[model samples]
Target: MIIVHDRKDVRHEFDVPEGKALMLQLRPKKIGIIGLCNGNAACGTCHVYVEKEWLDRLPDPDEYEAEMLDEVAERRENSRLACQIEYRADLDGLEMTVAHRS
Candidate 1:
């Protein structure tokens, strides 16, 4: 399951396919909130803040994602590019906020 804290409202999705990128999974449900780069790490629009406790559970951002993160004005210790994350069974309870675009 993926839980998103958006617009002061909480949303959840439980049927995400494993190995699908997080950005792709969020597209239909989240609409304009993320994935402006079409799942590529080209844009900073898909930035998100991973819950602190789940930070270590996720892999470190790749070079492309890292570059994008650095470009995001909202970048924080827990920030990540949704396009870089692959939904997996281990990430069932993952939670994050859709970051404001910079």
Candidate 2:
């Protein structure tokens, strides 16, 4: 999967196998993702925005993901955390935008 930053045009790729958490894929790349609480859904620092085209491909966010996103400075319908999202083979080409907090 690859993540593209809208403003900077930066792109990151992960060699993720199915069933791995999206956050795990990002860690090895040192992509500046802040997975505070270690995937427990307690922090908003890991927020990212799924590209509109890829939104439906992802599972709906759970209650915790929703709550944490709400705390994000600029939450949007596509907003989610790298930690909260899991990867599947179908998401091999998935793209998302990293959302930075103020």
Candidate 3:
């Protein structure tokens, strides 16, 4: 269960299956998260900031995702592309803030 804090400050709890991408988990719920490239790691629409403690727990973004993230002005040290994050049991309590893209 990842607790996603949307840009509006609303908390959305989701049961993310192991091995699934975080973007897929949020899209069905219509939680204001949109992956314009459909999880291809080609778009920054699914940008989110993982809480500091959980940031290191996730895998580092790949070169493609890293390049895409650079396009987002709101990107931060803990910023990540949701489509690049795979779900895992240990990530149950993970919390992230949906980035407010212009």
Judging by TM-score against the true structure, name the best candidate.
Answer: 3
Provide the TM-score for each candidate, comma-separated: 0.89, 0.88, 0.95
Task: List candidate 1 segments past 4 Å from native.
Answer: none
RMSD of 2: 1.7
lDDT of 3 by residue, 1-102 (tens): 899998899998877789988998898787767998999988788899999999888878889998998888788999998999999998889999899978
CA RMSD per model (angstroms) = 1.6, 1.7, 0.9
Task: Decide which is better by TM-score, 1 or 2.
Answer: 1
What C-alpha lDDT values do all the predictions have?
0.81, 0.77, 0.88
Ten consecutive residues with minimal summed lDDT in candidate 3?
A: 24-33
Clashes of each: 0, 0, 0
Output the worst ten-in-a-row residue range by lDDT, candidate 2: 1-10
Q: Model 3 compared with the native: what TM-score?
A: 0.95
Highest lDDT against the true fold, candidate: 3
The lDDT of model 1 is: 0.81
Better of 1 and 3 by lDDT: 3
lDDT of 2 at 48: 86
Query: How are the candidates ranked when ordered by TM-score, highest leading?
Result: 3, 1, 2
What order do you get sorting by lDDT, best first? 3, 1, 2
